[model samples]
Target: MKTNSEKTIFEMSVPGRKGFRCAPSDVPAADLPEGLARGALPLPELSELDVVRHYTRLSRLNYSVDGGFYPLGSCTMKYNPKACEKAAAMTGLSALHPLQPIETVQGALLILHETQTILCELGGMAAGSLTPAAGAQAEFCGVKMIAAYLRDQGQTQRKVMLIPDSAHGTNPASSVMCGFACKPVKTNARGNVDLEDLARYCGDELAGIMITNPNTLGLFDENILDVTRMVHEAGGLVYGDGANMNALLGIVKPAALGIDVMHYNLHKTFSTPHGGGGPGAGAVCCVEKLADYLPGPVAAVIEEMTDEEPPVYGLVEPKKSIGMVRAFWGHFAIILRAYVYCMMVGKNGMREIGETATLNANYLMAALKDVYPLPYDRVCMHEFVLDAKWKDAPGIRAFDVAKRMMDYGLHPPTYYFPLIVHEALMIEPTETESKDVLDAFINVMRSIAEEAKTNPELLTNAPVETPFGRLDEVKAAKDLKVAV
Candidate 1:
């Protein structure tokens, strides 16, 4: 097989090729307006075979969770079950239009309502809204709810949102978007939030704190309860970023740990399709105090349940809702997939998901800690970060190691992220991966570490075995190209 194939559809076009012929019109041809007609339309002309083969080859070039081991840390890029996909594709569910009356789409409304109920029960929150498009939007919704609650209590002066230095980049962005000033909280030696520093900021001006439990460092903050207590005592709310919810699935609930409001990444925690900007759902849940301020059109049971018939489910706005954050019901298909995922996993399997994920992460961490320097040497929750800088291979960096992983036919773990670590190579072997696959990944990392010292040039000019060699990533970013 050829290593590289860069032919675009336009490039493969023939002068007068036709993939399909138009059927004869049943009615007479109508004339267009004076300015409506165009002399020519610029489109690729190719045979049906050529089009099919070209797209098929392109699809093969793309990497996915199904393709191989994707240990992208922070992002739980686990294998999505085919059963979820099948449920999402069901004609009874998929065929419904959003504009249909509530009575007509009762099944979908019930699924949405149940999904919200399940998420609330899992996160230990009172109520939730599954309207936010993705995690970031959900974070925004949570922040907005906090702002609304504060404003309602005549605490408009409380405008500061304390974010951890090791938080996802979206945390501060969400806070700012909600008209709150952001303050950075420091991380202690043990990777938990610095209580002393947090105490200093816990004043009337404090609106809340946005914390990621089992944070970006992939370690659960030991001082989480204290962090929340101080903020609450100071009359501020605590917003939990549940991006790493895979770790705490059934083991711990965010609300129990004093989180006033939080968002759950259905795409991450519930094994829905992730990536490609998405069709993602972020179900934002809150304590009873903030529930009324949630994003509108949350699924609810309109009519009470009876002995003979199921309860009537419908979309209802929270009493003091921040208003709709997304168009019509949000990503219904993604929500349906998540609903199916929860049903498939069940209660026992849900707990197992968390346990297995933590186990897999620790297993990988233990195997590679000697070869790669473990930054915060501790038990990681669901993912762990490692420093790629070695004394013997001083010149080799995390970027090189990441690129080199491609040569072994393995997708590289996230590198140069969470910003706190100097040369971070974060890895998360989600619960879906097997022991043999984890061992294979470990062997590849060991081989890469050895290659870094014995054959430094191999790491420098990495991915030589792949179809494309290492690229000028900076140039590719700055000099955008869209055409063939």
Candidate 2:
């Protein structure tokens, strides 16, 4: 609850009691622009405690994965080790500016270089670019590279990209963003990509196909080999959306199993703090053939035979590069965190992360299936999709279930996604969460099911304890604004 003495932003204003003091400017007052500042800025005035308390109260509203079991489907909100966070905050790397002299910031560069190398080996790609700031950006870069490669081969007619119905929505968004036509392929009842639909779309004009293995529904593509072969035979490249890489980190390599290029979301696969928005690192990896077209300036090592000092930064581009996607080699601090995460968990440990993630997800699926309807009943990967039909049948909806989760002091699973499933409740517990946490989460969900049957209103009129009740989503969507 808000304290009795608490003040809103407007209420906090005073005549003049600036908690944050500033020194006089070094520049002459007369040198300032005419209209820059004719009057004093109307800012908040409060004590240090007031400022701290106000912000701390605001921070409490956020339902973070670290705070509870957040099975947010494909987002993979795994626990980011505090040690990785500390390593990223190290003075040497975190304090360095991107524009600093190459020799002065070799440590940062070497970290990125080695991380790229490690990710390449882990994903079975020859080269990688740690430049795209997010997974979607990486997908955009990968798709653009596919377009560039096809355009160079005189296959300008090839402008359509094939994506599965079960693939992440970002697949089509990235495809269309690359200036190519987007074609959606259907998924089989078995929760795998419809290979027939993929073949039907395959042709000379098809640039590439993006597949998320252990896909959105949490089932692995049973015919992955045949699917890749079909795409390759059609003179097209294959790109894997590495969003589900958490499920394949050690079990399989997308590139080795016929994928040509892929993107790795550091925030998802690695131990980076997912800020729920920007500042996530998404590195793109590809084979040697595609290395020339990688976004630059990628980190490169230099030798110093002549003994004045060690050589400086190295950067090279091939014949048909996609150009710079972001300024100054992406988010170095986020990359540092991811690097620390990877190094902390070596090859064997990475495999364990994958294995445990898959095992936990499958276990959760089995535990909850009795109460919730499994859309695709099978052994899942690192996540599974559940249907809300039971809740929907008992006068309860997916939105009600999501809102009710808040009342139970639990975050809700991702709802209404993957498009193919109705009222999709995609859950991915991730390996970081323990079995006890999973059981507790399952119990809350199971309780909701029973409550929905007896006291349907309890679920429908849920989140009674939250600051905000059911949101008017349509109004919020139509009228875009956030409460102050």
Question: What TM-score, computed on C-alpha atoms, does each candidate reach?
Answer: 0.96, 0.92
Q: List candidate 2 stretches off by more than 4 Å.
A: 1-7, 12-34, 38-45, 304-313, 391-394, 477-484
lDDT of each residue in 1-484, candidate 1, tens digit only: 3222567777778899999999898999988888888967888899999888877887887789999999999889999999999988889998999999889999999999999989999999999999999999999999998998899899999999999999889999999999999999999889899999999999989999999998999999999999999999999999999999999888899999999999989998889978768889999998998888989898888899899988998888888999998999999999999999999998778899989999999999999998999879999999999999999999999999999999999988988988888899989999999999999999999999999999999999988988679878899789967443
**Model 1 misses residue 241 by how many Å?**
0.3
Error of 2 at 101 (Å): 2.0
Model 2 pairs in collision: 158-205
Worst 10 residues of 1 by lDDT: 1-10
The prediction achieving the highest lDDT against the true structure is 1
Report the C-alpha lDDT of model 2 over 342-453, residue by residue, as the tens digit.
8889888989988999999998889889988887998999999888877345677777888899998888889999888888889998999887898898888889878878
CA lDDT of each candidate?
0.91, 0.85
Q: Which ranges of candidate 1 are over 4 A from the true structure?
A: 1-6, 23-32, 482-484
Clashing pairs in 1: none
